[model samples]
Target: MTTEKLVSEIRKKHSFLCVGLDVDLDKIPSFLLNEEDPIFSFNKAIIDATHQFAVAYKPNTAFYEAYGIQGWKSLEKTIKYLNENYPEVFTIADAKRGDIGNTSSRYAKAFFEDLGFDSVTVAPYMGKDSVEPFLNFKDKHTILLALTSNEGAFDFQTKKVEDDEVYKHVLKTSKNWKNSENLMYVIGATKAEYLAEVRNIVPKSFLLVPGVGAQGGSLTEVCKYGMAENIGLLINSSRGIIYASQEANFAEVAAKQAEKMQLEMKTILDGIH
Candidate 1:
């Protein structure tokens, strides 16, 4: 989807919530395990229940990759279902695949053309050549991992390089890349404190923020420093919402969790207006 359309959907829904589909078979209800495609079944239920409250859905690649070919089929079916039934909802392939130029081009095509995801998460460690290929696609997005929400991020992202921080350098350098206007960033909610610094570098760029709920990141702090005129944030929640319950009423429980976040988002958007 176009960035304008994405912003429009957020306005219409009063939300910028992106529900993460980090489905693990062990975590889902035991009953679902009996289904022919338990993963897809669980995803469908959650998507149906929470679609109204969320503007996006991100399926982390590792969860499906663990199950091998069968898992991949489930992931394919999930995306196909969303494309057919709810095209308005943005889809993200949370596949942090980045490599050399040629390899990166294939990775970009696989997600953008083959899988039909609106965006793909890309690691920027390989520098601009590895990431620019993904940005070349029209109407597609390359969400570069910046200050991620993980303990290890401190190892490099926060380390000072020259006069500025490493992640700050990443943010500034990204603007010089090809087709960077289509670029979004992954700024972990755990790194919410650095948002003001990030904003000075790319004020209007959208940020795919993970680390809410389960990671104990403050939603209010994220918006306070990260929000742009377009409400440029896609706050993500995974197990906290999808696996809220492991029983037959899992979908209903997931919906309740999503509604809670959406209500908070509504209040934030109201303040913006």
Candidate 2:
């Protein structure tokens, strides 16, 4: 989707919520295990329940990859369902993929062309050549990893490098590449303090933030520091929402959780809109 279209949807819905489908087989309701495709069944219900509350759906590729080919098929079906049913809702493959130019091009095609995701998360460790390929796709986005939520992020992202933090450089350098206007950043909600700097570097670019509900990140702090004029934030909640209950009413509970977040987003957007 184009950046303008995405921002329009957020404004129309008064929300920038991105529900993460990080489905774990072990955690899902056991009754679903009997279904032909339990993972897809779970996802279908969650999407149906929460679609009105969210502007995006992000499926972490690892969750499906671990289940082998069958898992991958479930992912395909899940994304296809969203694209066909809710074309305005953005879709992201949280794959965190980046490699050499040629490899990145193929990865781009895989997610945007083959799978039909509106965007994909990419590791910026490999630098411009790796990320630019994904940005080249028309109307598709390349969400580069910046300040992450994990504890291990301190191992490198926060380290000073020539008078600047490493992630700071990653964000700044990434904008210089071709079609960088289509680029976005993954700034973990846990690192809300650094968002001011990240924002200064890419003021208009969207940010896909994780670690809100389950990881204890402050949504208020993230919005206060990270929000742009367009409300460029897609706060994600996986376990907290999707796994709100393990019973047959799982999807209902998940929808309620998502509704809570969407209401918060609406209030935030109200001030600026």
TM-score of each: 0.99, 0.98
> What tens-digit string does per-residue lDDT give for candidate 1 at 1-273?
999999999999999999999999999999999999999999999999999999999999999999999999999999999999999999999999999999999999999999999999999899999999999999999999989999999999999999888999999999999899999999999868898889999999999999988998999999999999988999999989998998899999999999999999999999878
Clashing pairs in 1: none
Residue range with the least summed lDDT across 10 consecutive positions in model 1: 190-199
Q: Where does candidate 1 stray beyond 4 Å? A: none
lDDT of every model, 2 decimals: 0.95, 0.92
**RMSD to true structure for each model, in Å:** 0.6, 0.8
Candidate 2 lDDT, tens digit per residue, 151-194? 99999999999888999989888878999988898999887888
lDDT of 1 at 223: 97
Q: What is the alpha-carbon lDDT for the whole of candidate 1?
A: 0.95
